[model samples]
Target: MAITDIPEYAHLTDADIEALGQELDAIRRDVENDRGERDATYIRNSIRFQRGLELSGRALLFGSGNRKIWALGAGVLGVSKIVENMELGHNIMHGQWDWMNDPEVHSTGWEWDNTGPSAHWKHTHNYIHHKYTNVLGMDDDVGYGLIRVTRDQRWKPFYLGNIAYNTLLMLFFQYGVAVQHLELGRVAAGRHPNPDAFKQDLRDVGMKIGRQVGKDYVVYPALVGAVTRSRKTWLRAITATLAANTIRNIWTNAVIFCGHFPDGAEKFTRQDLEDESQAHWYLRQMLGSANFDSGKTLAFMSGNLSYQIEHHLFPDLPSNRYAEIAVRVRALCDKYDLPYTTGPFLLQYAKAWRTIAKLSLPNKYLKGTVDDAPETASELRFKTDPDQRLTATVDPATGRRTGLRTAIGKLRRRRSPVPAIAGQRQAKDVRAA
Candidate 1:
């Protein structure tokens, strides 16, 4: 891809960026060359630990009547599932440890616990999403083709409920992920009329989903209760699985969202990619991603997405190496005067939700960018609305500033000055209509 000509990235010319890419690539090569007994032992031990936790949790659920025991079991099982999906599954499928020459642990050979198949996820996530990063029209991950996370997107009133629906989406996050690759949103919007096109895909994915569901809710519980012929035991096992899955879903969603959508991350239009350069691509990855500040334990849990900048730059690099490169990458960004988007985990979590909440509005700036214009408009700027708040300007169809007239009318009526939307941050140098 031609590097983007965006002036912000001019700090590093195409050649400069290429040299930087070489420097980063050397880091990966070093990790690749050094991969040996230590890496192998680490992964093997992690897997064993996860498996042991899963088994112990299942065993404990047999006597889940003890609230403390059930809590412990569920918590442990959730951690195992999280690690399996985030650290092991995500990294392995990135071909991070493929240098080990171990077939079973290789990206092509390993299967994850999620309902979504690894190959399908790799296609959508690794190939498409990573390649596109934050390109508005191309990247399915920009709001995952769901809620609007940026102001540029032409918004409809439908997004008003995204705050609620997004929560529900998180509750069933794996299910959302399973169908994200299908681009079903396009079908819903009537962009793709041929429903028959994805029939076989549906069957294949359905089987995977079915297998996961059966394992957690059916087969394992059936066996546990079979020995005693106790319906109570079966119910307990089912509940335990539900608990574990819920915890895993919430956590995975939180970590992933925090890395991509938290404050300081910007969204770009497809126009930004015209003649995109390698430097531009690298710049987008850096600017569009964020990290959550965390200690070792939380970093381990996040699959090192807390170092999302490092991961995006060298996706195929082993997870352990990300933390190492992160310090270097941060220094490079600082040298170039680039923004390093990141914050505390809980703080970023709140920002993601705030983004979901505020973006559920008609883009106030849409009039300036989009052709199909609305008649009425206002101008507000964003500064502190958890996420960036809307700042409406004059109507796109007609560059009329009726907002001032309307604001004056409202002032004359003195009908309890419209309490500036609560917790809303007005954009810089912009004001209410």
Candidate 2:
């Protein structure tokens, strides 16, 4: 077989795998031992959030500065807050700041700005989702928003138009920006609650939404357009608003879309939530999560999501630990006959684009009704292939469906395993026989 077309990766020499294993071992050690001072960049990230919040405070002051300048500053503050959300808020919420030992770590100031404590992200992402990895219906990581991430997603209005209506609601995107934490918190809890935390979350969300609308429509324009009648002044105000909003969109969406909506990922519901294996759950975190080859600095800056496998394996471990653990996670996958998924960051980014490109007026799959019944090659081809050759007929010699290779090949290229939509993370949770 041609080198490029090797049926199994084992075609490569054992030495290659061994070398990889050694490297991964080293990585795992480094990640586990990340008890040193906060890296310099992490400090900068903390400052970024603080600066945004500080500026927001100033804008709320309606201070003595030029109105245009204040508006511009407010605009910058808005984008900064969103940036803080992606870079800092998320990290704090994940308990990245646990080492700090300060209660404020979870507060908005530490930039761990959680909108709702009950959102399952705390439970789902940090606890169950990471623990379960990609189990169907059980882990929330595979679904983008409420809609399914896999091709077989049940299309329904709330689920399907999730992005559409959400986009419309967020046209200003600020609505999402303000309260993403609430939804995540809800998802993390996995069920409705009757607690003070949930009640507080409801109140906070209303206030934040009101604040977002005020910032975008009232506070922004009056402070920006009304005071700056000069053409150049008003134009700058508009430019600042657009720039800030654009930055906010790219910043928030990139990390999130990458985390859940990649090609090989799963979308589980209540049914798929059966008992899970530890190893299987870990593998899901590795496979379900994509690691873009963000440069070393950017990876750390991004809180290591570009190296998501490591993060899932060691959520309590700081992001700086990911670079060290990445190799070990890969090696672990190998030792257990699992796939270590990684790629050039941009290539993985295409998966996000494909997700958006495929976005439409929401379908049935979003409503959570995908039948787990075994699917036939014909059905697979109908969903994916235009050419019938994939399902033309089975080859008796191989005892495999005629189109098995083509269908599987498509999934494998996406670096996913058979039972394509299932979580690959279970490897970590399963006990050895």
lDDT of each: 0.72, 0.50
Best by TM-score: 1
In model 2, where is the ten-residue run with the lowest total lDDT?
1-10
User: Taking the tens digit of each residue's C-alpha lDDT, what string does model 1 give over 191-217?
Assistant: 865678667667768999999999999
Instruction: Give the Å error, residue 130, model 1.
Output: 0.5
How does model 2 score by TM-score?
0.59
Q: Please give the TM-score that candidate 1 achieves against the real structure.
A: 0.80
> Scored by Cα lDDT, where does model 1 land?
0.72
Reference-based TM-score of each model? 0.80, 0.59
Clashes of each: 13, 48
Instruction: Kindly list the per-residue Cα lDDT of model 2 for residues 191-249, writing each as its tens digit.
Output: 64656676676687676556655564456556644564554444454455555655556
